[model samples]
Target: MAQVVTCRVKFIPLQLEFIATFVYVYNMKEDRKELWDHLSQLSGNHKEPWIVLGDFNVVLHREDRLGGNPVTLVEVTDFQNCIDNCGLEEIANSGSQYTWNDKQDARIFSKIDKVLVNGEWVDQMPDITAHILPEGISDHCPLVVQMLQSFSRKENQDREAMRRIQMQLQLTPLNATIQKEEKELSDKFRRSIYLAESILLRKQSNLD
Candidate 1:
């Protein structure tokens, strides 16, 4: 059976900390129950923000597979039981729904790979998302997890400060002293605009 790895991650800028668990289940049906039991035990121990993700080698639902033998309740019960026991929720994802595809004329597609998080994780990072990239050479597609932190309060404060500065610049006469203040404020305003644009560009790039 594949080993389960757990680590603590700290986001320095946000002063946030969480537990991240990575899993790779052995592909055999009989071996998976032990893995599920182990994961459930781990989940019960961790109270902090936690995320577990990987190729589980099993589908959670019938909809998660296509062009394969019909998914039976017996095949999914163990996995579903583990999920409920762990209190883990699947992350919202974009791009392709199916993460694995057997490259053949009679193709088989399944969403065996997933990103799951606890309630604490959702409370800490509400905007977290997963993107499933197309499978190239490999049979399984790549999963890109993105955590978009909100800096709305800081951004709003900066915008308000800039607006006040602009009003002062517009109302004041262009004397030598006022001209110098104008130059300083203009530089600050331009810097803020540049920073905002940079942030927007970064988000757009992530989406692409």
Candidate 2:
């Protein structure tokens, strides 16, 4: 079955974080553009830095191939177009370059696995990089993706706004039962109330 895997890296340089999604297609020949379009839609909706990686089955160039019927010229062009359209760049591949192989031929290898990142996310990863690792039990090799930390102002503001909204929602009972003493106490205990409100908000949001 085809599968999508994701991992998140947070706070390396200053306060930047990234969510990386890897798509591993088993035997499907889905268009590369379709996959990139899907990723683009997701990023537009979330408005967060994203890294997309995995074995796309299609190679972007002849340099990426090892042996045996290489990916067609048309396919390579399509793959390149997909990467360009998605606004993602391929990260460096390391170690034994080839990522996939056929059991029958030891020399049959191909660099199908790849690591891609959104251009906006480049600043967050200062020193870290992505590379291809060795294959163990499977035909495909594992990849190592190193990430750095850098915080964006947008994420911080979003969090703060969310906190304020949560605080307002938690003050519901206070509006209904505005006892003189209760209101006075609530005003005085603003810090404590905010903390309590935030905790509950996180919990409720998680449930939803």
Candidate 3:
């Protein structure tokens, strides 16, 4: 079987770390743990914010699985411990009843996919939501998460306040000079009109 693929995306403005992984079916236990451990070590060491998401085949609890048999007790406990020990939080798992279905058997269904994140990343990020999208050709339902990346309200308002202060401070002598020049031009136009009228009056006096 082919190995799972992992990728990272760094958004500079938001100072975010987005780590993505896709795990294949065979040897899910060791492969998922190895992939997760790599991301988890990075999360622990780095001070900057980060989020991790992928197809984790093992379910953490009975609630995580929709209709599967509750027979794998030890595996479920180990998986839940892995998530907790890595300090990742699962977000919005109620959208789909199952992520994978038994092709031969219609009644058996299970959810083994999820989106997980750390605490620091969730604080600044908003409208972080996920839904199970339709996948006609594949066995796995597509996990879709809408990431709204922008400055928060407090940060934006703080920037506007600083801009107002800077503008007020810079509006000192140059603006005053321009206003004075405008008034002087008006006075010069009035004086020219008066002089023209006086010249016309003198010519009329001479004619009389």
**Which window of 10 residues has the lowest lDDT sum in candidate 3?**
148-157
> What TM-score do all the candidates reach, one by one?
0.71, 0.59, 0.58
Per-residue lDDT tens digits of candidate 1, residues 131-152? 9999989999999998654534
The prediction achieving the highest lDDT against the true structure is 1
Candidate 1 Cα lDDT to native: 0.79
- Across residues 1-208, which tens digit of lDDT does each residue of candidate 2 receive? 1256666767532344678787965454554456655665666665456788887876777777777776687667756766676677877656887888876755777887888877666533343466677788888888887632222333344355445555665776456444444554444345334434444555568699
Which sections of candidate 1 miss by over 4 Å? 149-208
Worst 10 residues of 1 by lDDT: 149-158
TM-score of 3: 0.58
**Can you list the residue pairs that collide in candidate 1?**
none
Candidate 2 yields a Cα-based lDDT of: 0.63
For model 3, how does the per-residue alpha-carbon lDDT over 116-179 read when each residue is reduced to its tens digit? 7776555434436678775467777888887533324434444454455446546653676545
Where does candidate 3 stray beyond 4 Å? 1-6, 11-33, 66-68, 148-208
Segments of candidate 2 deviating more than 4 angstroms: 1-14, 31-33, 148-208
Q: Which structure is stronger by lDDT: 1 or 3?
A: 1
Report residue 69 deviation for candidate 2 (angstroms). 1.4
